[model samples]
Target: MTSHHNAPAEGGTEELSRSLTNRHIQLIAIGGAIGTGLFMGSGKTISVAGPSVILVYMIIGFMLYFVMRAMGELLLSRSGYRNFADFAGDILGPWAAFFTGWTYWFCWIVTGVADVIVIASVYIKFWLPTIPLWIPALVVIALLIVLNLPSVKGFGETEFWFAMIKIVAIVALIVIGLILIFTGFTHNYANGTATASFMNLFTTGGGFFGGEFMGFVMGFQIAVFAFVGIELVGTAAAETKNPEHNLPKAVNAIPIRILLFYVGSLVILMSVVPWQNFSKDESPFVMLFSLAGLGAAAHIVNLVVLTSALSSANSGIYSTSRMVYALATDGDAPRPFAKLTGRKVPRNALFLSGVFLLSSIVLMVFGLDKSTGFSIVTTISSLCFMFVWTIILISYLVYRKRRPMDHETSKFKMPGGLFMPYLVMAFFAFLLWAFTRDPDTLAGLIATPIWFALVGIGYLVLRRNPAHQAARAAHLAKVADEQANARAWQDQQLNASR
Candidate 1:
């Protein structure tokens, strides 16, 4: 059996420190679960899907819970695994690691770009009506880069406070909503009127399906976007302190959070204002606050949404840099990206990600309307994220089949095992189908394959390069030796204990 000393470093000698604690992990998970999608996109969903949007959120959360569990189990199966990409390579091949790592990097970069642009637009329109869009966009990019340049703990702390703001806001909404409901409050709008009552959900609008089956389908699409960052907790597993304990706590709490933050808020929003009164272009949170007689409701909601965008962009920068660092270490990307700073931060990889994030400025320069540009970018980002999710499930299936013994021994095994992965994949397939139903989403669907094709071609080209061939061979040897050593140690412990 190979010794741990024989196991080569997968990324490099410099490793990401386990600085994130249970508190940090918990808040990061919550922060990821809540994003601008819920703050800004929920209005469109309510307008489109009526009261039934609640079910869409719940269903998406349910499926993604299993996906997160799969990821948690995979990360725990091996200590050397940095992220899903590492395990994908170990179980699948070098190509799987390359594709998954780069695709995840691409996913967050696209998401970051979209987020900064949205933040800029929000600032210009709401507070500084005279500023150019590109100015604020550039400033936000710089701010996020500086914030992430320190350490993983800094990122964790920033996300913690950012997430706290959102949590408080949602909880406040729920509390106020319950108060209004109990006091028999009523709100009248131009399109429709509603009262603070449970019966308002079905009786006022088109009922559960939201007047048309197509609306429900469209709700599924938007709701999928809202949950885009839910798997971020898995990404943080390697950097987490005591991941075995913290990871499960974060994953288990998802259902309760989804019910309260998402489903509860929607139910109250519809009860107070009715689905018909919601506007596609406005935020339901703002509208609900206004209905409750808050004069500064729009401004307050804008600030919350603005912070939400910044938090998401911050997460994008962090995730993308780490992913690129993983790719470079594995010889899938340029060697320079594998370099780390004295603070243990992936500076080179972070710089590269920040460079891509600056594309948002170029997007702003194009002068596309805020709503139109946002829709296009988010659709593409959502598509890329779906691809990442599919890879995780595929990797999980491969793990279960090839490592049955590992599965049997795993303390944090996925609940449904094979059935859950397949079931989740089917749900993803349905979401993809739903995408094809809308023209905007269909455009995104058409554009997504082009990226995969490019990555595939790049992989083929890299395979022919002598340098990459050597690096891949060395990495695989290290992985094999490491696994052997791990097994040897496990057997030794078992024998000694007996």
Candidate 2:
């Protein structure tokens, strides 16, 4: 294990600046975890799982909490580690880093492309019904690129406010829902009149699990998508101020966020409107607001969902660029991606990610229904994230065995130690089984291995190049020296503190 005192010095000349404050880190963490999945997809999930969707979220959240904890401890263990890939390389070997890094990059690219398409389509409906969808899609890609070009701080500020809107909306929903539930507000739906009450959740059509266990199993696919970006804070550790303090604070807040934002809001939505009343064709949020007699609720929710898409797209850009930059620095990607701008932003990397985001325009040109396109892309993204999470857990197990001394002495160690990683792995295996149950997710699961094969082929080709071999050797040497220095410094700090 490398000492935390040894900051990375090999690529010190072109590193991202630590301008993101504690507040920026907090909201960015929140922003990354919450996406269109909760706002838009929840309607379909509720329609399928009924009130049992609450249990689905809680179970997923409970398992992922350990994943986040494992990630937190890994990042804080070494100051030089930029993201999961860096630690994966150091602990697991170069191959782990290569695959994990590229896979994560691929995940965000697909997610970003899907998000911009959604954003553009929403804009066409709400503000520019007359315009072609491609125009707005191009404009959105351009706008986000400009927003990210300035610096890391600019990205942080944009995400902070974008996340605030989501937070405010959920809080408002929960508060208003409590009032409605207590007052026994009754709203007539197409099927029947639903009186707002706690019992409404279980009384509608059927009781918990909707009297069909398959419905509960089906919700697992979309529910997993809702928690896709929970590990994003681990990626931001290198660019955060006082990460040892801020990182844990952000991670510890995950349970509360899930409880309040996910479970709490779903309970409110179902209680206010019976689960059977939610339409798979529309957002449950819009339905709840409209049921409360808000005339423009559709438009309002449209705007909110639009911003949520943009926030997620923005995050995709930020995380992918950083990952690419890290890969380049390690000689695993094109050298240009490692070059930093005067403001210390990875401009080239950001531009490269933007180029892929333009592919969303191609989806529009094909005339696929926007909803269908989004569903396919999101399924692929969710499956890819599962791979990334699996790698993180695998790396954690290795870290414990290889660095027992560090694990015993570390301040931010994962609570469950050896047992937790295996438990989390088992849960992920169940998710894979759940994926096989649905044809859509099953297609994604089958298609995912082709991506790994492509990456493996690329790795083999890169390994044969003399220049690549030389670069890898030099990079490894530099990292080795840096780790040694870090360990020495950490020993001094320990002695002094004693």
Candidate 3:
């Protein structure tokens, strides 16, 4: 209900409220990283690797853990880190900052659009199961826009509840499944399709081609995608009350999360229902409950996914607005984006990002269903994030060469160090290969070049803006005046001494 349309015609940095607590940061990291994709998409990975899909999650989680470790090392190393983009610029170059800023902005925009589609579909699952997905998708988009248009605290609170719902759902499912595994609870499908009592989860289709080793390896890419948003914790640095203390706690919780959320729920799911029966199109969690004769589980799970979608969208808006703000402050984007309203929120930037978020509504007009529309936008999953990962890796490499002693002495150093980065980079490259293999995501990868090209052209175009030129001149002039004033003050003191 609060309007952001009153932003000043004058543009500059906005001092936003830093009310976010450690609880918010931890939950935001957990919730942002583990999205609907992990809950639903993991089902597909289950079929590929059977029980071994658990390894896929752990492996990718480990690799990313180190990546976050590297980021944390640099971020906490100096208080000067405003955001990751600034760090990239400081270590790499101004161009690195510009590209990272805008690419990250696009990444979140595309991601939020995908989440919007999922939220709409989740709504339709109830009243109008047969109704087109686009109608509900639009409604969900409108609702999140309303949420995001408010102050930062409003978004944080909404995400707090949203994440709590998902946590409860996963916990409940894990508890119920564990009981069945222990007490041998019988279900309708328990006798017919049940592959094995416990080991069926890892039966490995047969031998080499069986769903064990290679299958688990094959699922790594998707599993990695599921954890794509984990680093979102870093993005909240500007809003966090005390980023240093809170960030370490949030990052340290990743291993425990892997154990409980990813491994724990997954093991229970495999135990309750055989991995082979997993339906790629629908969430395996919903299927497990339906098979167990629980009518309410489908609706409950749907609500959880919808909540996840909202969280992802909220994060997307929050992150994209910041990235756009960074770009403008660095002169990579229009100065208008850096402008803020009285609330200290980037209102204009939020509006601009919201327009990109609404692009999903147009996807509906293309005669595509929400899933397909969602699919198109979701293609940025690997490309944009991988680019970020690449930049981070490159930045880390630069950090080591530039400051070897710092690398040797840092407490939060990545385990493998120089050797590990090469491995992580190789892993990232393989994931890209995995992305290329999928037809649904291929177009997004192809389109990445065009987007980068636009950024290149835009950077050059913005270089010539008259207002921008004037702003640059004014900044340089101010710097000169400060220098002249310092000289005159020193001379006046010398004259008094004489």
Candidate 4:
């Protein structure tokens, strides 16, 4: 891969600086891959599909890896393209960019609100059970805002360590569970007793598919949430030091990360404790450690999961701010959001996101049950995230068709060529159908179109503004110039070859 950095700023004034290095980019990618959904939602998935949840996670990860590859190629296709929104606006027109930009902003905001709620009601309650929920909720959002406000480097560093804690926790669980399996450990459950052995995978409980086809199908509904933020590396493209090198390195490792972190961890967990014994309402991570007789297991796992939530909220705040900044600079959002602090941080956008996150406390004030509220928000988030993923694939398809020369010359090309995107899109369509089969997710599915309707309305209105029209025309003109120049260069090379 080529080493492409953002062009240096003329006056070194309000532009986003490329302060994130390879390590920062790598860890941030990891943080995005491993969300609270894996930590907190795994038990539900295990309960739903039994041993088949492993396959469910594998399928989701496998599909998403292609999506990420498509996004990586598009981001690197042109130095002028900052993120997907840039290409979406350039290729799909300004409306696509505006729609995607705002939708992505909303996706993270909803996710952040959910994370804030979980931290306050569930994680904090594990320790300070008597504390008012709103206090912790507000504090979590405030802390994440403060963490991101210092500088982009500070945001990267915070996510780096937060991701490290999650990695260490999962690795520890895998290592300790392996030791138990080798030693033939056994644990008692309400359903039945299970011995710690590889045979537990098939010999105990309902085996794979949880003994029902529908259960396996249901597994996909919950498992999809665990992979929500996998494309966050694409959003960080503009701020990365070397997009061509670091982007590929980070994207290529996704399969290994899924194997070790998601599939591997689930395999080890079930081996130690039979799948039937796992509670949908509780964490399998804590149960395994507690059964293994770690006196502090619950507390330790609680801390890890808490930090996982914090890391997600931190990402939401960081990404949402940048997305707004992108939208504003493109004339798709209010101009104030484009302003940067002396540290080059999007201060106005950051505060606006935090303010939206505060609505989590407002939701709590209505006496919503933690589980129900979190489920609704997360379901909507998963649906919206799928929309974003679908756009990335569509953008890739358009890129390949319209810019075949760029595709041919790309050092990092998407695997599966023209066919894979269509296949992935079909898979996503099936996933949407899968969501409709469940009542909770079905509610989210029905509600999601309303967001699009509003976005469409907003775009229609925004297009009337002369400033928005000028910005759109200028962006398209620039892309046309770049493509024309490329075609001319190709013609010159052909003539010289003769």
Candidate achieving the largest lDDT = 4
List model 3 lDDT by residue over 1-498, tens digit each.
Answer: 001112233454345567789878888988866877777888888877777788778788888887887777777755646577767766675667778888888888878877776565554556577887667776776676688667777777888888898899888888778777776765445336453246655552452234755576668756766776788887777778888788888888888888889988888887777676676777888976775568997787877887777788888888888778666665667778877666667777888888887777675557554554455456666577878877887888887776555565676676666877788889888777766766665666677788899888876787687644554464456435545665676687689999
Q: What's the distance in Å from true for residue 362, model 2?
A: 0.9
Write the candidate numbers in order of decreasing lDDT: 4, 2, 1, 3
The stretch of ten residues in a row with the least summed lDDT in candidate 3 is: 1-10
Poorest lDDT segment (10 consecutive residues) of candidate 2? 1-10
Question: RMSD in angstroms, all models?
Answer: 3.6, 4.0, 7.1, 3.0
Q: Over the stretch 112-223, how does candidate 2's per-residue lDDT look in tens digits? A: 8888877877645577787888888888889889999998899899999999999988887888889999998988788978789989877787877783788898899878
lDDT tens digits, residues 1-498, model 1?
A: 102211333454567879999999999999988878888899999889988888899999999888888888888888778788777777777788888888888888988888887788774469999898888888888899899999999999999999999998899898888889899997666865556887888877677666488899999987887888888887787689988899889999999999989998998888777678788888988878887889999898888888888889899999988888777766678878777777778888889989998888887788763665666667888888888788888988987766666787898989998698888888988989999998888877888888899999999998987756875676578667656866776687789999
Leading candidate by TM-score = 4
lDDT of 2 at 461: 86
lDDT of 4 by residue, 14-103 (tens): 469789999999999899998887877899988889898899999999999999999999999888677787777777778888888899
TM-score-better candidate, 3 vs 4: 4
Error of 3 at 32 (Å): 1.7
Candidate 1 lDDT at 467 equals 56
Question: Which regions of candidate 2 deviate over 4 angstroms?
Answer: 1-12, 466-498
